[model samples]
Target: MTTQSIKVTIKRGPDGQGAFDVPAHDNQTVLDVVSWVQQNADPTLSYRFACRVGMCGSCAMMVNGVPRWTCRTHISKVIKDGAVTIAPLRNLPVIKDLVVDMDPFFDKWVEAEGVHHGSLTRHDPIAPVDETSATRVEANAGIECINCSVCYAACDTVAGNPDYLGPAALQRAWTLLNDAKDEGRGAILDAVSGSGGCHNCHSIGSCTTYCPNDLDPMSAIAGLKRETTKSFFRRGR
Candidate 1:
């Protein structure tokens, strides 16, 4: 049997870059390539992955200059010229090879008030919500985000404006805003209405284009814009 090989180049921060020739197999994923390089070629290689099945976005990286979940990206789909390049996600500080500091991305999540502030406590009764309601539908649209930072890495707004809250955080805000049991609507609006808020988005649609889960953050940002406008008028400011 003949062995098939592929060239894999990885950007190693502070240690320069490394390239390896690895055996390739059919139905292989980008994460598989990375893992092969780490195990067989270079044990020093550092990366992140969990639930290689793709539910967890921890394996997200830059594959051919695009942010993607390595676990979900098939090598056959992204291989170019019999080679592939892997790098840490962009729009965030690189912690090491193929690893980025996620603090900024998550800090903006807090800034966007992504957490659910419940209107009721354990002592209170469960709130009945109509599943078919417009608010519920809108909220459910963006509630599946796993905070993998793929969308944030793909966002041009965050690349230009360091203070800009990226798509994931803003999308979470949009989800929480429509939650009938949430009591932080006003706070969420205030967070996304500032200088580094959703208005700063250029509507490049990169977030939606790169989302691994197919979530439409562009629409969420647009909803924030409309709601903020209404909020402004309500404040009479």
Candidate 2:
């Protein structure tokens, strides 16, 4: 019996770059291919993955020019001409083969004021949250983000503007803004309304298109825009 094979090309930075013909199997995922390469072909191949079930976005990579979670991306879905190309996520500094520096990606989150600032301390009585409220509904829309950076990698605005806060950061800001208990509304708005803020977004929807969790960071940015505009008008009055 003869085993079928697929061509796999990996972008291995300056020193190493090449393709390998690996045995293909049914229901094989891109992660599986990469793991095989590291285990059989090259032990030096470096990549990051925590949860292979798609919960952790650490396995995200550029597959065929699109950012996708390698663990969830099956070879059958993305294979073209019996071949696949894997590279580090774009708009980030490549650390090595299939790995990119995530510091800058996370730094933007802090710059966007994505962290929650509460008015109450831990000793204070916990306030009951109205889950059905309008603000809660909007907040819930983007709260599922795992900071996978998939949307960040797909965003063209981030590619062009290095200072621009990427989709995840801006979306997180919007999420915090809608939280009833959050007291950082003023700071978040001020942060996102700056030159490299939400306005820098091209509204291309690539963040939404590539988000593995199906969260819409594009819409969240639009929400920030609307809120910022309203904030601008209210201050004038």
Candidate 3:
């Protein structure tokens, strides 16, 4: 009996594709296929992975032209005609084969003021907050993001407007805005109110669609739109 194999085509960073014949197994993931090629075919094959169980979100890549967590993507689900194409995430600089530069993705976070700006000091007593409050509920909606950049790669807005704060950053800003202890809500609103902010989103919902964590970045951006608009008019008042 002939051993079953899967055709793997990996797009190297600016160098073009590297084709390989990888042996297939039951319940094999895309990452497993890549790992086989790297271990058996080409030792130079490059990629990223951590906590392969899906919590880290570092194993994201373009599998068959769709951004996905390779560890979570089973070959059975994605492979077509015994072939799979793998490439680096889009809208970001490719560092090597399947490894894209994440600096631009995270930089948008800084630009969006995604970090928490809390007024509470270590010396200050612990403040009680209602976990079931609407604000907390809203904050929790977008807080599970692991910075995978999958949504960033899938985002059409980021592709059109390079300066547009991508879904993750805007989602982060939304979460921070709803945080009751945050002191930088005003600054965050100002940051996201710019031309490159939440308004740039077309509500295409690609971010919500491709998120490995199943997050709702589109809704978060919508929240930012409403909040920023309110802030704009409040300032006018």
Candidate 4:
């Protein structure tokens, strides 16, 4: 065991004075140490967690200046010399301690027009799709996202522009576009092509790297851009 105590600084409140420190433990993750502080060190500690397995995007937070899912982040790997800092994810208003309101994060989904507008009702016959089709394969991995905004927090574009749809929404739009049967493709493209749309992304690939699911939203955004460009030329943009 490393004989070093990882220093963990956490945002305690809304006040500018909101700050607290905790020592690290050997083989401990940021989440584990935070849980330790909340359980034994500080009773007033507040944070969010579900499925401690990293499958749920609920436990994302700023660790050592980067947004990460605490459950999967090991303190030994992140904290330097037994030093660490924790806080709610950035680009979102803090509720308290370590929890940030997710309404805005999810609100972007609707804002992106992520919902499919296909006329095919649930009662309609299920259209046959080639499982091995390129588009289906493209849609496969992206559909696995659990709605965690780690990518959102890690995105500098979202930080720069609040109205930007962020990675997840564009990824969802890409998924719908790949559906081939969805009727909302044009609207999705148009919505994302405008201000705060898919065009806003600077393509830094932060969303690709931080994604827990290994999905590349940059690629999805690229796909949207290509589709938008094709339509743009067809319509004289």
Taking the tens digit of each residue's C-alpha lDDT, what string does model 1 give over 62-157? 998999999989888998888999999999888989888999999999999999997678999899999899999999999899999999999888
Each model's total of backbone clashes: 0, 0, 0, 6
List the candidates' TM-scores in order.
0.97, 0.97, 0.97, 0.92
Segments of candidate 4 deviating more than 4 angstroms: 16-26
For model 2 the local lDDT of residue 129 reads 91
Q: For model 1, which pairs clash?
A: none
Better model by lDDT: candidate 1 vs candidate 4: 1
Over 4 Å off, model 2: 1-3
Off by over 4 Å in 3: 1-3
- lDDT of each residue in 92-170, candidate 4, tens digit only: 8888878898899888888777886777788999888887999988877589988888899889999999999999998
lDDT of each structure?
A: 0.92, 0.93, 0.93, 0.83
Provide the global lDDT of candidate 1 against the true structure: 0.92
**Poorly placed runs, candidate 1 (over 4 Å):** 1-3
